[model samples]
Target: MTMMTLQDDLTTAAAKGNTADVESLLRRGAAVNGVNRFGRTAVQVMMMGSWPVAQALLQHGADPNVADRSTRTTPLHDAARTGFVDMVRLLVAAQADPQARDNQSRLPVDLARENGHAEVVAFLETLK
Candidate 1:
């Protein structure tokens, strides 16, 4: 397959939360930081509920701080927006910047609070 196709596949697998496929794609030399057709890295589109997928990407050197091309929101922003606290934790462990702002100039904690994720808001407050 073409390199672009391989990279897209990696992002697709990550988005699907198919950990095995993500791992296999990584093993096949998919660029851990490759952006898909949407110009988003796998970590950017990865399923919010799949910590294993996040872990695989992080271990493979996926940049935890990469902001979305349009929204300028990092993976942690997405996780916090979706109320996936575990995913937030995983990204933080991988050195995601909690203070990173999006196009709206709102932090991940702001998104978490806006989404009514009290636990996530609480967790992020401790990091400040």
Candidate 2:
């Protein structure tokens, strides 16, 4: 089997909420926007449900607008999927595209609604 690339390891660790590993990897020159085979970056993976990891990745230069391959999902999409209101706010504050659409043409707000996050759906409305 081939050794895991730094980007792959970083994304997996971030998805699993390993902040220390993410930090060490970033400090060691891991690309913040590096994509794995799934086109998911450390930021998107970390943004799943961990605000601290997402914030750390952002502070380390992770691009909020980086899109995945299939859905072209952004960190905002991941944050919305997890119903993380704070992370959503942070991404919006960082100028994340509120109108960014996935392959299914679903925006972050749409995902928030579909996921039944009333507060998030309301918050997105205010943004628009």
Candidate 3:
């Protein structure tokens, strides 16, 4: 059987919320900013609602500003979509572009508002 590539394991670990495995893979030379078939990095995967896994990835040097392929959506965009206030704050503190827009020209705040995440929308408004 062929062994899984580091990027593949990292993506799977992020998706599964496997913090320990993610950390291990990261320490074993996994690319913290590795992009999957969807152009999502480990950090983006974590922003998809896996806070613990995201935190682990972030601590390991995952780039919060990494953009997806088509939409160019950052991890902050994923955080907003999921209403993860802590993740949003972490991404912001990590220097994520507060005004970064997707292919549709929608910013993270716009997405939060569209998704009815009042608290997230309010926080994003404060950023501007």
Candidate 4:
């Protein structure tokens, strides 16, 4: 298969929370940091609710801080926006930048608070 196809499969696997598929793709030399059609890497796609997939991607060298091309939204931003504490922890341990801004100059913490995620707000406050 083409390199682009492998990358697309990797992102799709992560998005679907299929860790086995993700690991398989990585073993086949898929680009861990490759952006899919949505301008998000595998780890960024996993940030929606799949910490295991995110971790798998990270272990395979997916860049935790990689941002969406249009919004500049990193995995941390997605995790915090949805109050996904485990995802936040995973990204933080992977060295994601909590202060990184998006296209709107909004940080992850801002997104959390805007969504009424108090626990996420407190956690991010400690990081700052």
lDDT of each: 0.93, 0.83, 0.81, 0.84
Global lDDT for candidate 4? 0.84
Q: Per-residue lDDT for 21-105 in model 3, tens only?
A: 9989988998898776555777866626666787787787777887787678888988898797877787787788989989999
Model 3 lowest lDDT segment of ten: 43-52
- lDDT for 82 (candidate 2): 74
Per-prediction TM-score, please? 0.95, 0.89, 0.88, 0.90
- Candidate numbers, best lDDT first, in rank order: 1, 4, 2, 3
Per-candidate alpha-carbon RMSD to the true structure:
1.9, 1.6, 2.0, 2.4
Over 4 Å off, model 4: 1-4, 37-39
> Which stretches in model 2 have alpha-carbon errors above 4 Å?
none
Candidate with more favorable, higher lDDT: 1 or 3: 1
Per-prediction backbone clash count: 0, 0, 0, 0
Query: In model 1, which regions exceed 4 Å deviation?
Result: 1-4
Better of 2 and 4 by lDDT: 4
Candidate 3: stretches off by over 4 Å: 1-3, 37-39
* Candidate scoring better on TM-score of 1 and 4: 1
**TM-score of predicted model 4?**
0.90
Of the candidates numbered 1 and 3, which has the greater TM-score value?
1
For model 2, how does the per-residue alpha-carbon lDDT over 14-92 read when each residue is reduced to its tens digit? 9898888888988898888888756678876673667778778888877889887766888788778779898898888
